[model samples]
Target: MNEYELKVFDEIEDWKRKITRRSGMMNRVSKKAQEKINEFIPEKVHELMTESIKGMVKATLFGSQLTTNRKQAIGLSLEERDELVRIKISSFQKTAIIEGAGTGAGGILLGLADFPLLLTIKMKFLFEAAAIYGFDTKEYEERLFLLHVFQLAFSSDEIRRNTLAVIENWEQRKKELVEMDWRKFQQEYRDYIDFVKMLQLVPGIGAFVGAYANNNLLKTLGETAMNAYRLRILQKAQ
Candidate 1:
């Protein structure tokens, strides 16, 4: 395999390590939660969490494979790598929001939609928001920044460490990229341009924000909000 191909493999390996470690952490958290629940509640709650995590692992694996394949197909250079990541991250983030808003059977568009369409929406929403809020520079900038961050897949320390390790492996393989120089990859150019064109045909926004928001927000706000959200959803079903 060429340097590019090697880089992709290395990245995959790192992803595996990160996923394993994170999964372990999640497992521990789930175990502790189950213990607490079992203390008060009569029956075992193991199956629900166990099943959810199983599904999460499956989803994680699928995402990793898709990303690896795309990276290999495009033979992305350092520049293209950044661009691809930006596009994917932003689109992923927007999809998360839609998911949180409750899309039901449709799933989030970014996760399930055609890639071209998903890419298109991210760009369109960004520009349209810019035009509408041009004079209000602060808000526009904030919105734009949030959009970019949403695209950033792993921002939290735990997730970031794993992501960085994966990127570092790629950096080692793609020596020409100057070791983690994602900035030079010009991800914004491809991500934004593609998003704009796609918007005319299909529209969307940030999934990462909601993920991060849910994690961070709930962390600070405590479990009450989560329980409330859960109870509400359950109530709706009943």
Candidate 2:
């Protein structure tokens, strides 16, 4: 499983930790927002809200491993925040494009449920930053392909329940293992791969359509592809 799959269950908890973990930065962002409060909202509570906005934005931009997240977050101004959000939306739109180009059944299965959730969260920030951005029906076709794939692959009720159970287990364990031991994590990772292979067979579909049934699978492919690209670029620099 990739980090996102590992993170799926405890997404909110991890986010809470990330926000508090950088308290000084949070304070600074809050401080700035407080300064702008009189002009923006005139309410004292709204002024205090600057920190929450700042912390949330900071986390959204830096928290996710997606390159688009990091890229759009930099050098932002209040004026530019809206545009940044647009870029973030477009970035995911491009992901929809790639998913359509061919991630096969496995890719499609993963995309349906997963993409919408991911897009929903990403857009929540993007939309709030600027009111104009919202979910597009035009993008539905490709995203639907993903949903179809997931539904087909994990068609059985029992398998879905078991998969979810493991996900919950991973989430519960992760908080306790925040400063995880690499060697142990590595072993667990190997086991994860083994488990995925076993589950993949259960779907009994073609490569193109198979694993797409589960939302988790597409995330793995997307992350792995991006990581490989980054690794190659770094290798060339060396």
Candidate 3:
């Protein structure tokens, strides 16, 4: 590997180590508390949450209609493509911040609206990222790759490791892979953002919390997408 690629590989190792590390005591406690809360809730409430998450997951997985909308940057080097992606990520981050601010300002009602809206923004950004990286989103497998990238961005450590393994060996694993578990996807995603997103529902400081949280979340996704594609690209070069 060249110097830059070597550097990226090292960074990927660091990221993996960080993400796969055991959760701290506080995090474990928080997770346990949430689990307990869920247990206490009526089955009907659980059913409603399942339905809601299912709807979000369906909207995400079943429809990637934006594939054609992401203009491809043909004839670019990986470095050039990623520079353009940086620009795209910046633009999308601004859009997310605006959406978060607007929703947060509307208090409880619009805070609720933020879920689906943010999901749409994140998916669109991923589609555009894939296209910029010279991956065709029109293909089903490539779209499935995007879902794995999303999961890697938002899943728990154990789930993230499993997702990363699939990503790292997607060519081989995809032969055996079917659809992802929608319930697991929804649970991990909700759990990953539960605390900060809860703050976005607060009446007084919701706007600020929403904007900050959305900005950070997009940053995380952008980094994950960039590195995931980098691994693929570099692996192919080898």
Candidate 4:
């Protein structure tokens, strides 16, 4: 491996360890609290939420593909691709921040709208990242991989560990997997972001909270996406 590739390999190793690490006391307590709250919610409510998120995500996936540049980067080294992806991440982050501030300023109605808007921004960035990495997002398995990457960024510690394993072995694992578990996907994602996002609905501080939360969220997603594609590329070299 070149020096840049080796440096990235080490970074990926550190990221792998960090992601699969055990959760702290606060995380455990928070997860349990969320679970208790979830139990009190009606089953129908859960079903409705799952279906809503599923539809929203499916629509975003379709729309992102329509808008994403179809041309895959070719004849580029890992460093070159990484440079392009960093630029894309910065652009998307700015977009997310603006959208968050706008929706958040509009109160509850617009705060609610931030969910889908932010989701679309994240997915579009993932598609761009995939293309930069020379992966064709139009391919079914590639899109599915992006979903796993999304889950990895937002899930609880246990789910994150399991999802990382799937991503790590995706070349072989994709053959065995038919489709994602939409219920689990939606629940985990919602649970992960619920607290901070809820703060975005508060009338007084909603706009500030929304912009700050979205900026950090997009940053997390960008780091996760980069390391994920790095893992795949470096592993293939091995």
TM-score of each: 0.28, 0.23, 0.89, 0.96
How well does candidate 1 score on lDDT at residue 31?
42
Off by over 4 Å in 4: none
Per-model root-mean-square deviation over C-alphas = 20.1, 23.4, 2.2, 1.2
lDDT, candidate 1, equals 0.34
Error of 1 at 50 (Å): 1.3
Scored by TM-score, the top model is 4
For model 2, the superposed segments whose C-alpha errors exceed 4 Å read: 1-71, 75-180, 201-210, 217-238
Taking the tens digit of each residue's C-alpha lDDT, what string does model 3 give over 1-238?
8777787788878877777788788777777776777678798776777778777755764565544455678888777887888897898899999999999889889998999989988988888888888788777788778889999999766788899999999889888867766667777788778888889888889999999999999999998998898889888888
Question: What tens-digit string does per-residue lDDT give for candidate 1 at 46-84?
Answer: 445344433443344334333332213144343344344
The models' CA-based lDDT, in order, is 0.34, 0.34, 0.83, 0.91
Task: Give every collision pair in model 3.
Answer: none
What are the clash counts of all predictions, listed in order?
Answer: 15, 17, 0, 0
Q: For model 2, what is the C-alpha lDDT against the true structure?
A: 0.34
- For candidate 4, write residues 1-238 as lDDT tens digits: 8898899999999998988888888877877888999999999999999899989999999999999876767888899999999999999999999998888888999988888999999999999999899888878999999999999999999899999999999999999988888888998888888888888888888889888989999999999999999999998888
Off by over 4 Å in 3: 1-3, 41-48, 60-64, 67-71
lDDT of 2 by residue, 180-216 (tens): 2222222222223333333434333423232342235
Q: Report how far residue 192 has shifted in candidate 4, in Å.
A: 0.8
Mind sharing the TM-score for model 4?
0.96
- Worst 10-residue lDDT window, candidate 4: 68-77
